[model samples]
Every structure is written in structure tokens, then in C-alpha cells.
Target: MATNVKVIAGDPSQGRTKSSPFEHPYALIPTPSLPTDGSKPHGALLNAVEMFLVHNILIRAINSILYHAPLVKLHDDIKDFLHFCEVFVDFTNLHHDSEEEHIFPEWARACGQPDIMNENVAEHTTFHAGLQELRNYAKQTRDDTTRHSSEEVIRIIDSFAPALTTHLRNEIPTVLQMQQYPNGDEQRKIFAKGVEKGAAQADNTTQIPFALGCHDAGFEGGKHRFPSLPWFVIMGVVWWYGGTHKATWRFCLAICIVGQRRRSFEIVVSEHTRR
Candidate 1:
């Protein structure tokens, strides 16, 4: 896949610049992006914050199929379930690789606490092997063209779910707390750099749309967290390159958030609170 970079605007509102004397060493950095009026959960953690929620939604999708697909007696349902697994695995690898290689380092640098994210990085090792095995299984299921054991696949996925979910849940607060970095503009710059790096590594056909599909832009009474390009441009890219490869996205909660409304390829969110 050829590399492409997408530019998105940062939140216009500025946050508090002062550091309190009583504040902890890693005080949360004030940001205009984080909700102040308490209208919604702020998305200003985990480097690419929105991606954090999107990751949870993906894990939920994978877990749902693992638990429920076994009860499905029909062969077609089993097939569809396996297909969803493939999408989940691919999307996860793409996301994780980006985090490990690009995003985490930025957060660590901004925090001046390189060791702060060490545990999160270590947690990735625990599930790395399981993720690889699951991906291999997904591929084998696709290529074998035979009736595969849904029970076995579910067990494989279930084995990894606990660890994966732990990392996902634990990360929310870890990242939310990173707001103590004391420089919102610098933090925003780091975020943009990470997004650009991830975009360059992405496959426009599969990964781009898959990432878009994972985003729940409707969070907090229908608002997005990033800037957007023209609707036609985004739609054009997805339609032209994404092709007929997005079967599993419909099952994602992010897409369901908008109900029957047309999906946006552009990523957008408001950093302001709903006062």
C-alpha cells in the first residue's frame, strides 16, 4: 500500500499553563481538548486518545464473536465470525505496531518520565504471541475452504481476551493522567506526528477504512476529536481503494453509533465541553 498523510486541526481553545506547587510530579497537563464542564469522558490520554476507545471497541467486537459465535449452529454464521476475526487481528496488529513504534515514545518524551509507560509496553509482550497465533489461525480458516471448528477458534480467542482487555482498560487512566505533561501545544504536535507516522504505514484499501470504521465519532452527543477533510475526498479514497473488503466493519459498535446515517471517512472531534 502506498503511503499517504492526512492533516487534521488541533483544538483551538487553550488550556491552563500554570503548574501548581502541590501538584504531583506527573500532573495532568491542562488541555482545551479535555472536557472541562464534565459533559463527557475526555479523550486526551494514550497519545492518540481517540484510538484508545477505538481499540476497546475492536476488542469488544472480537470478544463478542468469540463468546457468541460458538452458540451459532449455522455454518454461515461460523464463516462470518471467522471473517470478523481476520479483520480484528489485522486491525490490532496495525494499531499496536504504531503504538509501540511511534506513539508511546512520544508520550514518554513529553512526560520526561520514560519509565512511566514501561508497564504498558511490557504488557504488550504478554499478548504478542497470542495475537500472532490468532492471526495465523484466522488465515488458515480463510484458506482451508473447509468446515473449521468454531469451538476451537473461540477457545483460542477467549484465551487472549483477558490479557488484551486488561491492557486496554488499564491504559485509559494511564493515558488520561498523561495530561500532566504541562504543554498542550507540544502534546498536540506529538499526536499529529504519531498520526502521520501511522498513516504512512497504513494500507489505504484495508487499514484506512478499517480504522475509520473503528472510530465512534458520535461520542458525547455526536462530536468528533480530530479535524476532517472534505467528505467527498475521504469517501473517494475509501470507495476507490477500500473496495469490497469491509464486511466486518458493520458489526463494529462505532459504526452502529450513527445508526443508519452515512459513515464519515474524515475523523473529527470537539475538544470542548458541552456547557
Candidate 2:
């Protein structure tokens, strides 16, 4: 895989045109003012923040392809960008699936709010369809050597941009609102468990690397805490499984060691660059 990346680095296009979406600038959700000490029912907040981060990354990737369509001539660049798309889709799908199977159901049962997460659940269909379309387009682009224009991919993304953005933006506040449940104590416990279970369910190989690649540890003065994972697995198991792909995630930093009664986990992250 590493060798293939460099082999196709040479491709030429002398006079192609550059074009990007000109309508309006896209805005990402501001990272919420979440508590640092874990006093709050912040499982939802952490999960929502992860979603927001991935959403922003995916949108930016799409925009980058379209924005530099003219300048990007190498097959390797296109392939790498498309690989990023696959990772994005995989992460999004894994997250939503985990929520539907574990997180949402637990939240509903614990909070006695059966319909609280229904809207977010329903919104998945709208974006999932678009995601599938974009994924399919990316696959096609990957397979076809003659293919150059990203206009179709751009159009497909634009077709669902409104609904996708709405779902991404709206769901954060909805999850954040779960902190206000009447049975607050039980709800916090449930959310924490749900987050842990959801993380465990994800494919350790792609899931861990993709997440580490996208997450910015420096954000908010390096004080922001991300959901923690086990030290043994991250350092031992994950490192072995990741293999060649590990180089792509050199940005990861082992920030902290989370010790609980039942288990202990280390936080893998990126270096915090003080701005």
C-alpha cells in the first residue's frame, strides 16, 4: 500500500480549469463549551463532538477536491482523497450503527424518553443515502483511470448538503439536551456505558486510525478531553494490527491514562500545538 502511493505520484495536466462551490461559505459547528472534569453527563457531548469533527472533515475533503480540481493531476492525490472518503464513510456508518444498536436505545430507556433520539435516528436515512451515493461515486472514480472531473461527486454532495448539514448541526444540541433529563443520575451512567460500548464495537484497525487522524488534540488549549480507550489495546493490540497504516497516524499522541474500577485505558491523540 505504501509503495503504491508513491508509484502513482506522477501524472500530468497542463491546462485544466479550477472551480469550487461559489454560493456561500460552509460553517462548521463550534466545539461546544463542554465541562472538563467529567462532572456532567458528557458522554453525549463527547460523542456529538466526534460527529461534528468528522462532519467538518468530510465537508472540507469534498470542498478541497472540488476547489483544486484543476490543479490536482496525480492519480495518487485522487486516490488518497478517495481513500479519505472511504474512511469517513466507515466512521460515520459505524458511529450511527452503534448509536442505533446501543447508545440511543439505552438513553431512551434510562431517561424514559423513547422519542428523544427518534429525530436523530430518522435523520440518518437522509444522510446515509447521500453518503452511499458519494461513496459509490468515489469508488467509480477510483476504478476509472481516465476519470478526472469531480463535478459529479460535487453535485451529488451538493444535492444532499442541506439535509446532511441540518442533521449534523441539529443532532448535537439534541444530544446535549439529554443532560437535562429528569432522572439525571441514571442518565449519566447510562450514557457513559453507551459511549464505552459504542467505541468497543467499532473495527479497531480502521476505526482507531481514522479517528486519531481526524481528531485535533490541540484544540481548546489541549485541555479538551476526548473519550478514552484502553492502554493495552492501543499500544499493544492496535499497533500490531495497524501495521503499514500506522505511519499515517503518527500524529497520534498518548495523552492520558484513564483508570476505572473495572478497566483502564490510554488516550491516543495528536500533539497539542499551542496557538
Candidate 3:
């Protein structure tokens, strides 16, 4: 299947002194467009809204690592970089877990088709080992510090990124297919409830802030407010929680605060070196 992928380019005005070699003009996975027509199936549209918002964050996080990995100094910068990778792994796992545990089962039951989500579950197996390897590498490197290798990090991601991204992109259309089921309004409610439950189960202290850090609010002309939280939560709560690992969060392509404007994609090595 043809997939639309576009590389995220860093704006020169965002504080970078020179163009990053990893900033390809057009090679990253593009977020699937949500439907606007009122006549469209509401269930599919709602599913698209939820899936696209989270999927875009996942795509950006992956691209951020790909764009910045080569710039990291293995010995001096590996600590924070590995933490960032670990956060990525955690967030990705949480999303898939939510789907498998909450969203997929609910949707299948609602549709009266136990196998509706089987393909997605199978796709998870394709990248599960690679993701686990990444998590293990990050933890091991943090303990030893000497085993860190930027190339090895990138190599692990490369092994699974294609399959991982393909699953991310394809699942959008599969969810959209829920439009064909009867009782559209009821299905939408079911989806919303599943989404809410899944979100409530997350470890807000880490996963929430990690997701905020991954999101670029200015994406696609800045029309959406994702993971939409109250102003106080974003400014007061998320800001406080995100500070727990201040240095590690810096590798994120965007800030974790509300209105997450673009920041330079370069990972700072000097700060870690100083410590």
C-alpha cells in the first residue's frame, strides 16, 4: 500500500546555527488527514481524530531521534539520549497496550467481530522484539555508560522503524473502517469511552509529560490542540512533572508546555558533559 510520509524539517529561525544533516526536506511519515464533511460517518471520524493525534506524536518522536542521533557524542551525550529513547519506548508501548487491552477489545465487541483487530495485534508482534531490544539497550547503557553507541541506537531503530511506522499508518484506515458498522452514534460513544479509559490508565508523571514533549503543536498549520488539557494542567502540572528529568527532555523536538512551538532538533552534549 502507498503511504504518505514527509520528513520534518527544522526551521532555521528556531535557533539552530546550521542545517542539521538529519533534517530531510520530505521523508517522514505524514499524519493521516481527518475528515471534515458533516455527512461522513461520525464513528470513523472520531476514531481518526483519536488515532491521528497520537500517531502524529509517535511519528515525530521517531523522526526526532533519527534527526538528532548522529549529532550525539556517544560517551558524553549517551546518558540523556538513552533516557529519551527509553521514554519513546515507554510511550510507544503504552499506546499499543491501550489499543490491545482497552480499545481493540471494546471495538471488536461493539462490532460483534472478535477478529476485527487481529491484524493490528499481529502487526504488534512484528516490532515487539525490536522495541524491547531498544528498551533493554537504553537501560543497560545507563547502567554501564561505556556500552553506549549512537550507531547501535540508530541500528536498532532502523531494524523496526519501517514495520513500526507501517503499522501506525495502516491502522488509521482500519479504524476508519468502523464506519461500516450499524448504530454509528453508539459506536462513537464506545470508542470515546475506550479512549478515555485507556488514557486514565497511563502513568501521568512520566508518560503524559513524555507525550507532551514529543508533540509539535505547530504541525500541519497548527489547527489542532491534542491531548487537550486545561491551561492549569499544561502550565502548572505538566510543567512541574516534566522537570523531573529536565536534561533528558531537552532532546525532544518540541517543548513540553502548552503551545509546544518548534525547538531546535540538536541534542545538547555540553550540558551533560559539564555534569
Candidate 4:
């Protein structure tokens, strides 16, 4: 749960490296560290910021897939790619739903600021339509491979990427600002409960594996510890559950069960190709 991690920008121009594929083709949002000193909001609010940062990593991974994956040459790989896109849409929607349903209301009540999170809510709306369109496109393509259009998928992402990324990045500071209130302990409990409720509703089989696949355990010299599942869950449950969509998980930057770093999936048609 180390929170002092800095943002890492994985430039595709650097070519394939020994790093985890999750870290490539985009800039990751950095998680702000909790102050060791007796800071006002040193507890749950900071932890929420950390979790948001983790989600941002996955967000960037989906963007990487859109830009870096060799969709045209993929052929059979397109099936898994479409499935991956579906998983991305599912995870993002669930995260936002959980925030709106469980986290935001509670925070507003506790801080006596009902409209505090309205901006974030509005931001979600800005990207909702485009995200749904991408979801529909991915599902349609999955059902009928002939419908697969990499260009269309990229266009949909382009339409929403600005608003989506803005919301993702802006929410961190808003969470941090909650420290101005003297209810760190209470805010901590609210956030923890929201996370628990969200986790309880997630699809362990697909969403869990998809998240682990995008996470890099060795990030920032292995300082960050995210998705803090036990070894048993990682080795046993994820290993078996991910079997349902093994092909889709293969496109993941890290092994779905274990966060081992590997090269991201990409196709190099010519020596001068850069994506």
C-alpha cells in the first residue's frame, strides 16, 4: 500500500523493454503519499487517493491497448482484444457506480457538503455515452467478428478520453481536500466500507483477473502493494477463475494471477513502425 509512487510514462517509441506491459504506451497517474507527519487527513482519505491511483493504472492500460495492440494484424487475436475491451468497460462502470452509490453520498453527509462531489458526478456523465458506445461496439464485435473496427473503437475512446482522464486525475485532489475536515477516522471508515461494498459486487472471475493483469507488482522498484489479495487468492482463485477467458487475459501486461512483468502485446509490421 505504498502511496508515494510517482507517475511513470511508458513511451511506445522506447520499443519493447523488460518492464511489465501494463506500464507501456501511456503515462500513469501517480498516487500521492500519505504524510508521515501528523497530517489532518492521514488515514482513509489518503487511502482512497491510493486506490484511485490503482484504478488509473488500469485506465491507462485500456488506452494502451487501443493505441499499441496490432488490431489489423491480430486476426484471431481480435477476439481476445474485444473481450479485453468489454472487461475494461465493465470495470470502469462498476468503479464509477460504486463511487456514486456508496462513496459520494456518505462523504457528502459526513463533511456536510452535499454538492462537494457533484463535479465528479457531472464528469462521469460527460464520458458515459461514449463509454457505452464502446461497450456496445465491443460486444457486437465479439458476437460477430465482422463488426470489428479498430478505427471505430479508437474513435470512441478518443471522444471520451479527455473527459475520462480529467475526471480520473481531478478526483485525487478533491479526495485529498477532504482532509480539511476533522473527520479523518470517519472518512477512512466510509471509504473502506465503500470499497468493501464495491468488492462484494464485483465479478471475481473476470474483473478481478482483468485488474490483476493490468497491475505491475514491480512498479516503482516494487514499492507499491495494490490489490492486496493474499497469495492463496492470487495463486488458487485467480489462476482457476481466469481460465474462463484465458485468451483475453493473455493480452494483459502481467500474468493475470501473478503480477510478473512482461512485454505488452504489439505487432511490428516494419522496422520504422512506432505506436
> What lDDT does the true structure give each of the candidates?
0.55, 0.55, 0.69, 0.68
Q: Write the per-residue lDDT of candidate 4 for residues 81-113, one digit (tens) a residue.
A: 777888888888988899999999999999999
Clashing pairs in 4: none
Assess every candidate by TM-score: 0.68, 0.67, 0.82, 0.81
- Who is ahead in lDDT, 3 or 4? 3
The candidate scoring highest on lDDT is 3
> Per-residue alpha-carbon lDDT of model 1 for 109-218, expressed as tens digits?
87788887788878888777777787787677766636577777767866786787777766666776766656656666676677788788877655666655544444
Q: Which stretches of candidate 3 lie over 4 Å from their true place?
A: 1-41, 74-76, 257-275
Clashes of each: 11, 3, 3, 0
lDDT of 3 by residue, 127-204 (tens): 989999999999898887777777898899899988998898878778878878876777777767777876687666
Which residue pairs show collisions in model 2? 230-265, 231-266, 253-269
- Model 1 has an lDDT value of 0.55
Q: On a 0 to 1 TM-score scale, where does candidate 1 land against the true structure? A: 0.68
Ranking by TM-score: 3, 4, 1, 2
Model 1 segments beyond 4 Å from truth?
Answer: 1-33, 37-49, 71-81, 225-230, 246-250, 253-275
